[model samples]
Structure formats: C-alpha cells, structure tokens
Target: MRTLTLGTPRLTAGLDQHHRVDHTAHRELHGPLPQLGADDLITLAGLGSLRGRGGAGFPFARKVRAVQTSVLRRDSTARVVVNGTEGEPGSVKDRMLLTRAPHLVLDGAELAARALGSPEVVIGVADEGARAADPVLDSLRSAVDERGSGTVFRVVRMPDRFVSGQAGALVQGINGRVPLPPGTPRRTSESGVAGLPTLLSNAETYAQLAVLAIGGADRYAQEGCASQPGTVLLSVSGDTVVETAAGTRLSRLLSACGLSSARAVLVGGYHGAWLSGEEMSRARLSRDGMSEVGGTLGAGIVLPVTGDTCPLGETARVLRYLARESSGQCGPCVRGMPALADSFVRLLSGEGSPEDVLVAAGIGEGKGACAHPDGSAVFARSALRVFSEDLSTHSLTGGCSRPVKGELPLPDGYDTPAHPRLLVDWSRCDGHGLCAELLPGLVQLDRNGFPEEPDIPVPGPLEGDAELSVRMCPALALRIRAPEPGSAR
Candidate 1:
C-alpha cells in the first residue's frame, strides 16, 4: 500500500523514508511521549474535540470520561483495548498504522492505559494466526518489546469477519469468546473484557491520540478544520492510503490518487452510503461534511467507480456479499439481509421493482444485534438514490448493457471457500422440498418442508446432486457457495 500525505504529516510523519518506524526512530520523529494523567488526557481530547475514527465518530473525551466513571463506581481497574481489526474490506488505514507505525499506536495505547490506571492493554488485530511472520502482529510485538513500558501489552488475533470490529465484538474476541456481538447491547465503557471498565477504540483513533499527545492540542488543531482537528487517514480504492486534513475536499484526494472523475463514489465501506459524482465533487472528508453529503466517513474508506461499469450491478454485488457476511444471530440480519440483496439483484436484472428494494432495505432498520442491518440499509438506500439513472435504465431496458466490473473489492477468501457447500436464502425459500428430494444425501426437509440445515458442505460424491438441487429449486433460493472467510468448512 502506498502512503501519501496532503499537508503536514503527524501520525505518518516518518513513513516516507522508513517502511516501519521503530521505537527509537519514532521518538526522534515525534519526540518523546509526554506523561499525562487521566484528566489531562481527557482534557486534551476534549480541547481538540477528538472523535473515534472507527466509523461511529463518537467523541473520544466522552468515552474516556465514561470509562473513568465506571472504573471508580465499580472499584475496578480498567483495561485498554486498541481495536486494529479493520474488517471492512476497503479499509486498510488501521492495518497500515499497526504495520508501518506500530510505535505510534502503542504509544497512544500506553498513554491511555496509564491514564485509566490500567495495567493491561490488549490490541486486537484480525486473526492472521498466532504466527510471528504476520506483518501486523510481528510489528506490534517488536514495538512492545522496544518500548518496555511498565504497562503490559498483549496482542490478540480477532476473527477477520466484517462485523468483528464492532466495539462489543472486539472486546468479546479479546476475552477469547466467539468474536460476535452480544444479542443484547451493552456499553464497553461500563463492562467489557472480563466485566471491567474498558477504554477501547480503533487503531487509528489511538494513533491520532498519540499525535495529539506529542504535538499538544494547539499544534494538533492547527492543521484541520475547527470542528475536526488533525489529519485523517483514508483507504482509497484499496490501493492508496492518504493522510489529509479533516476538511480536505474529496475531489482533491481522489485526484491525488489519480482518479479525476467517477460515476459514483462509495464514501465509507460496504455498509456506508454511496455518493453521485456531483455529491462527491462537493463533499469534504469530515464527519459534518460527510453528513451534509448524505454519507459518513465510515472507517475512512473511499471507493469510486467510473462509468465503464454498471453502478447498480456493483451495488448489488456488494449488497450480496454484505448479506452473506451477516453474523446470522438475528432475524433482521439473517433473513432480511438476503431479502435485501435479492431485491437489488432482481432490480439489476430488471426482474424486480424499486419498491421491492426499498421495502427489503427497511426490513432490518434498527432491528439487528449489531449496526450491520442499519448500515446495510443506509448503503442500499443511498445506492437507490444516487444510482437512480442506472436503476431506470436497468428497469426499462433489462439492464444498462454494461457489465459489473467488480470495482468494489471483496477480501481474497471472501466468498471463495476452500470447500463448496449448499446454502439457502431463507427470504426466498417457501418450504421447498425439491432440493431435499434431489439431493437427499446432502439435504433433509423438516416437518415444515424447509431444509433442516440452512447450510451444508457438498461432498465430492454429492457434487452432481448438489448442482441438480441448486438448479431444480423452485424458489431459486438454493445456491452452491464456497465457505465464507470465518466459517468452518
């Protein structure tokens, strides 16, 4: 990944010369880490109006204050968690920080631990295995050794699924449980990671904090807009990571990355909303700016698609991937998401109405265990709005006659499983027993005639039957898919 800077660099100060900045080099570039107490750090964050860069854009000061309050009330020591799990496929800023600027992230994490009176600091990266060869895990481990700070830092691997980066889910993964969000919502500041008050934020957020600490609030506030101070990192088109001031024009950043124009830009990641070229040209890279453009700087992902590809087709592909990536713990996500994806696919094929997509998108709004459903809804709705021209073409003429270029990227092992399996989309399935009859060895029908197992891996001998069943399903709900990224084959 190439790193570029628009203005003066803070978190990415020394990255131009060094691939990975070590502790000694980091100190030389940024100067020594300043010692600050809990109140001081919180005050500094408030002065800069720092907010978490992990998509939510919550005020960092409020989170620290809430954790401190919980610590005192519970009479418990807090735990500091640095969430480095950048599960959004289009996002790589956090991973880049963890790999190329490990010390900066560690410095911020250590400062938070010291302020919160916590001895344990946990850094959660996506599960690339426990092997020391992993770049992110290795860089963090080496940095911890070099710092030799009094506080203990433990780097743990988290599931690399899309929703695994949720604050609650990250905490749960650090606790060694399944890295999925809890059914009932709970605040990490109150009880997290072994039921202790936790100060958890994304990797970039902590790196930004370290930048704040080194430069003080005044210097940090000098670069970006008054509302949002300091530089923000953006993962653009999955190839370039740019560190630019908060209010930098979106068009300028795209030009810097060699993208002069586009039909639509996906501001944020898959769960984020889409923006037409006009909106993209007028947009800024801040929270308020993105809101004005009817989007969010979700995980700082900026992806643009030119007119060569069908925008609706691209959106449908992403929606389908998002539907498959659901945690499958709630009705809204498991059932509603597939329906949403189906609606989009049908629209893309000119076999469904726009109302179908709208209704399906609303099925999961405000109703999932996590924000996946709502965010997916936002993405779908925005696509419908931004790509209305493309929608009309597809609806009237059976398509725009343009192919899906797959401009939006999915992770390598994303739907491509090592083993092929039979999967069902419950939203379209109507107690169909045709699959069960065709592939009795691989599928079984329950009393309701629905497949007893929604998902089943196809054996080598049963591949033929699986194919026949998939082709013969009356509702067109059965499909043969490879194992998803985190699923067991």
Candidate 2:
C-alpha cells in the first residue's frame, strides 16, 4: 500500500523513504518511548480526547480507566492488546502501521503496558496462511526483538475473517478458541484474554498514544480539530493509506487519492453508510463531522463510487459477501443475512421491490451477538437511499447500462469457483420434504422423508432452485453453504 499525507505526518513521518523502519531508525525518527504511569497516560489521553481508531470510536481514556479499575479490584495483571486485525476489506491503515512502521505500534503498546503495569503485550494480525505470509507479523516480531524492552511482547496470528477482529473474538482467538464473539457480550476491559483486565485498542490507537506520549498534550493538539486532536490514518479507497489531521474535508482526501469524481462515497467499510455526492461534498473526516452528515468515520475507510459502475449492483455483491462472511453464531448470520443478500440480488436484477430489500435489511437488527447484523443493515439501507435513482431504473427496467465493475475490494480468492451445496441442520430438519419438493433435481427425499445426498453440490442450473428450497423449507432446516477450498462437492 502507498502512503500519503495531507499535512505534516507524525505516525507516517519516516514511512515515505523507509520500507520498514527498524528499531534504530525508529528511535532516531521518534526518539525513545517515554515512561509513563497509569495516571499520566490517562491524563494525556483525556487531554487529546483520543478515541479508538477502530470502528467503534470508543473513548481511549475511558477504556484505560476501566482496565485500571478492573486490575485494582481483581488484583490481576492487565494485558495490552494491539489489534492489527484489519479485517474490514476496505481498510488497511493498521496493516500499514504494522508493516511499514512496526516500531511505532510497538512503542505505543509497550508504553501502554508500562503505564498499566501489565507484564505482557499481545499484538494480533490476520492469519493469511501459506499463500501469502503477512509481513506485518514478521516486522512486529523483529521489532520486538530489536527493542529488547523489559515488557514482554507476543505477536500472534488471528483468523482473517471479518468478525474475527471484534475485541471478544480477538481475546477468544488469543485464548486458543475459535475467533468468534461469544454469544453473550462481555467487556474486554473487565475480563478479557485469560480472564484478566485487558487494554485492547486498534493498532492505530496505540500508535497515536505513542505520538501523544512523545509530543505531550500541547504539541499533539497543535494540529487537527480541537475536539479530537491529532492525526487519523485513513485507508483511502483501499489503495492508499493517508495520514491527515482530524476534521479534514472528505473531498480533500479523495482528491489527494487522485479521485476527481464519484457518484457517491462509501464512508467507512461495508458496515458503514454511503454518502451521496452532495453529502460527500459536505462531509468531514472526523467522528462528529461524520455523524453530522449521517455517516461514521468507521475504521477510517473512504471509498468512492464512480459513474462507471452500477452502485446498486456493487452493493448487492457486498451484501452477498457480508452475508457469507457472518460468524454463523446468531440468527442474523444463519438466516437474516442470506435473506437480505437474496433480496438485494433480486432487487439488482429488477425482480424484487425496494420494500423487499428494506424489510430484509431489518431482519436481525439488534438481535445478533455482535454488531455485524446492524452494520450490514446500515450498509444496505444507505445504498438504497444513495442510489435511489439507479435503484429506480433497475426496478423499472432491470439493470442499468453499466455492468458490475468491482471497484470495492475483497480478499484474494474471494471469487473462488465453487458450487453451492445444500446443508441440512438435522436438529431443525424434522424430516420435512419441502426441500426435496422445491429442488427436485438437486435434492431427494429418503425413507424418512428427509433430504438424501445432502452433501450434493447443486448444479449451476439448479442453484436458484436450491436457494428456493432453503427459503421455502417450513422447518428452516435447509441452508446453502458456499463451496470452501477443500470441501467435497
């Protein structure tokens, strides 16, 4: 990823020339990490009004205080987690920090550990497997060894799935469990990672802390908006990571990325809302600014939708991907997501109404174990509103002239060639023959009137029928699982 800056770069200062700033270079560039106690760190954070660069924008000082309280009350050591799991396909700022400027992130993490009196700092990066090794992890490991700091640092690989970056999921993965949020919500500050008070924040948040520690509150607040001082890292259109002071206009960032025009801009990632051209002009690249324009600077993703592509079609593709990416631990993932994806697809093809899309978008709004459902709903609804004209054309006469140009990015192999296979949740099957009747060619009823050859891959011609079978099943036992890498077809 390329790096750009709108103003004097702090986090990205030395990144322009250096491929990876080693410990020696890092020290020279930013000076040594300053020692700070818990109270001192909290004071600086409060002064800066620092918030998690992660999607939530939670107050950093509040999180620090929470972890401190938990530690004092339980008499337990706190763990500092540097969440570099940039799972949102639209964002790469965390990865940039880890790969290009690893020491900055480490300095921040180490500083936090020292202040909190924590013995260990855990940094989580996406596990990309053998196909592509994450250099970020390697850089982090090397940076830790180079520092030779007293603080113990462990760099661990996490699943690259979208929801795996959630605080609970990250803690769960570090604890050797599946990296999915627990069914019941729990605060990581209160009890996280080995049942101890944990201070977990996005990687950039930690880097910002290091910046604050080095520059002090006054210098840190010199740039950016007064409300939220300091610079923010944005993954502009998934191609460039730009570090700019807070409250920069959205148009300036887009122009800096060489984007001259766009029909609309998808602020934040898939979970974020879309701003129309008009709204985009007025949008500011800050938390409050985004909210004022009915958007969020979620994870600092800014993607523009140019006129060359059909926005509705692009949204349908993303909705389908989000539906597939769900953790499958809640009703939203198991049913609502697929239904919403199907509705959007139909809408894109001009076979379904906008009402269908709206209703499907609301299926599991506040009922999921995580915010995935709510975020997906927000994304879908924003698309409907921003692309109302294109939606109207599609609803009236099928799709528009433009084809589905994939301006938005997904991970490698996201478009894997695989057929949809029928999966039967036997617990809910109840031996209903509705599936077999709906997909006569793809599914067959056995002696018990349950689906036979449930593992069979539906033929391309019958994939539609297979989906229909799933939707029509009275028991809601049938689902279509997309083919995985080594799954039997």
Q: What is the TM-score of each candidate against the true structure?
A: 0.86, 0.87
Global Cα RMSD, each model: 6.1, 6.0
Runs of candidate 1 with Cα error greater than 4 angstroms are: 129-132, 413-489
lDDT of 2 at 253: 87
Which lDDT value does model 1 have at 96?
92
For candidate 2, which ten residues in a row score worst on lDDT? 412-421
Which candidate gets the maximum lDDT versus the true structure? Answer: 1
Q: In model 1, what lDDT does residue 99 have?
A: 92
RMSD of 2: 6.0
Candidate 1 TM-score versus the reference:
0.86
lDDT of each: 0.85, 0.84
Q: Please, what are the lDDT tens digits per residue for candidate 1 over residues 275-342?
A: 88889889999998999988899789999999898888778777767776776566677567767877
